[model samples]
Target chain A: MTARRTWATARRVLAQLRNDPRTIALILVLPTALMTLLAWILPDSEWQKYAPPLLGIFPMLVMFLVTSVATLRERTSGTLERLLSMPMGKGDFVFGYAIAFGVLAIVQALVVAGVCFALLDLTVRGSAPLVVLIAVVDGLVGTALGLFVSAFAQTEFQAVQFMPVALLPQFLLCGLILPTEELPTVLGWISWLLPLTYAVNAMQHVVVDTQLDTRFWVDAGVITGMAVALLALGAVTLRRQTR
Target chain B: MTTAAISVRDLTIVRGPVTAVDHLSLEVPSGQVIGLLGPSGSGKSSLMRAIVGVQVMESGSIDVLGQPAGSPTLRAQVGYVTQDPSVYSDLSVLANLRYFARILGVTDDSVERVLDQVDLREVADRLVGRLSGGQRSRVSLGTALLGSPQLLVLDEPTVGLDPALRRDLWTLFHQLATAGTTVFVSSHVMEEASRCDRLLLLRDGRLLAEGTQSQLLERTGCQDIERAFLAIVEGGAS
Candidate 1:
């Protein structure tokens, strides 16, 4: 709950990440590479049309995997127990993670969008900053989701298993494969409930509009609320000590 | 005049059908290095966890620093190092200490001071993962020393250490005690009992005896603490 302690936790997480070069590469470089590969694999005609929404999805997916596993490491390593025994609260621990990964998400979004827009020629009618903004927001959502699911997992392998449970549904139903309206009625309703559905919708809104539009605002609000709710859940489930 | 650093009364902890600490009543005096001695699974860990306010108990109470165990006020006052070297192995020793000191709101100079105490100053920038097992443990110990905690709770810190390193750590514990820090150390190694200011001998979640080395030796009429422990266990059973 204390801001100073939360800031300290964020710095500690960043320091830990800095020490591992492989993880750094994974965090800063992998998403852009995968997005480029996506541009290559898909037909040229389809790639740009899909790229904007995919920008949102890419960071969320990558950040989710990385954040969940990293937090799980903190749990297993006994550092979490030590900190909780100190003057640290669950809010400081979880939100501190949010701030650290929030920084990572910004850097990641910029790199991935930078490469796609500059080289792959992904077209956007709206402002480029809006595209980057949505991508960053999606990354935050992914980080929140990662932190929440890590509570259920004891080992790194178990954390990986949680990805499918927490993320795959959002992918399948979030309009990546098909627009939410074209799906079966039950699935369409379900997709409306998924945070990534709003992420995809908001990105699609950006693809056609010139400035911040009303529909984009609505989707942004919903998904942003989703991020806050998920982060709170993460804090609630985070244990001070392993019983 | 002796004041209680820690006081536990009728404490019971049930961990899924096993009574880890059953009706345990004991008091640790201020500024004394009290050893909680027991065989493996004798509830030493459970008792330590209770005293630090991390473990859930079935009934009873523990008071630490005149506050209920686990109170927010005591979080900074009580320093606990688990059996595992819980420090981040991925970070440098200095980074580990700095991060903990920040959480405790202690000055960063304390981080350097702790590095000196744990003898990790030479390898301050070295990643904890690269250190020897004994060195990694020192990092955990260094973390607990931050903020000049009033009470230090260490759980089985010497379980896997070499004899020389173990002796050195014992020296550090006594030094901290002399500075008016109540150090509670747990050990299953009977020989280490002689190093503590007083001892609480536990077996199967209950206290067998509590006294100084000489008192325990004389009371049980044995030559050494090891034999004295066995005799007490046998006599208590009968």
Candidate 2:
């Protein structure tokens, strides 16, 4: 396909995103509401005392879950196939979705940040830009995984079914409700592979200590790697799905 | 006459352990209306998709509009309409047309012309899912017609249309052929298949025959294309 046609496909996906009010609301509202709830409920004293990980990782869960509704719907409704049949590249579609979901993630993070600053009286250890950057990376990882899920899923129900398969394991290993340090060696190794573990570690540093550490960079790297891997798998799966 | 618009040599599609389209070799010339007539599971839809590069073949070669089918450059030159009316249900008729036109690299003027030709101008603002079945077919046809593609591949375009509308759609296909677009339509209706300039008869994942309607009728010593088809299949069975 020509460059012009690729642009047109991106424009079409954007238009559909705009017209689908339910998706628009989910994209814009759900993350912020979840963020507010998590921020007010979890504090440094409570976090350090009981479930420290959940306080930091809750936003990552919300970001990843958001893609399930929008991306999965597009694949199920035949919109993705329709786009593929046209003069659009699979890479373009993936990138377009990444950008859309990334924006929504940022907006959600900001709302949570706002709530964190005001109600929870929290401050980040790292630079504000670094904190947002980590959040965006987590969002991209979520969206990429969602894209892979949509590619293999034959129906909306199948797509939704992936959420539990995707979320429950991450929640367990992410050190969100359970501390990774306290987990067994085998489980700790598994947690290291998950993108959420790194993301929460990075965000937690910023949200709690207001400092940038090696852990932040390490988290970003892991999440970025997961995004790339998921994207490659998503492309191959999408190609096979259409074929 | 123009060169063959689509040339397939040893085209084969395999699903699991079964050969869906087995070594199907055929040449379709430009401006000719060709029918891929077969029963269910005879690979009609699979063949159409293979020709358009939407289906991957296990072993085969396809040249569409003098270019290999899977090449992105060549893929853009042929229009493919699938079995379903896959327009967004929430979008207006005009919105869907414009969206497809843009994706196919056609301008708004071309979109308007195609919609007008399909008689969708009056309901351009209506939602596509609300449109009648026949009207949806026109929209699908209009999408394929945009950019004036050199070849058109439509799989079962008239499946649910009333007899009258089906006939009208055939007329539109003929008109398109006159304008130099090679039209390959898949249909199970024998009468509809007879209207094609040439016919390819397929059964059990193999090519049963390929020739003009009259040639098939004469060769099989049958009264009509439908009888010719039945005779050949029954004879093969026995």
- The candidate that wins on DockQ is 1
Extract clashing residue pairs from model 1: none
The parts of candidate 1 lying over 4 Å away from their true place are A152-161
All candidates: TM-score: 0.95, 0.86
Q: Over 4 Å off in model 2, which ranges?
A: A1-7, A32-79, A112-133, A152-162, A221-225, A240-243
Best by TM-score: 1
Where does the lowest 10-residue lDDT sum fall in candidate 2 chain A? Answer: A47-56
| Per-prediction DockQ | 0.68, 0.39
Model 2: chain A TM-score against the true structure: 0.82
lDDT by residue for model 2 over A125-217, one digit each (tens)? 456666567766766777888887866676678888998898779878887667789889999999988888887777667656655667767
The residue-by-residue lDDT of candidate 1 on A175-222, one tens digit each, is 989989999999999999888999999988888888776889889888
Q: Report lDDT (Cα) of residue A32, candidate 2.
A: 54
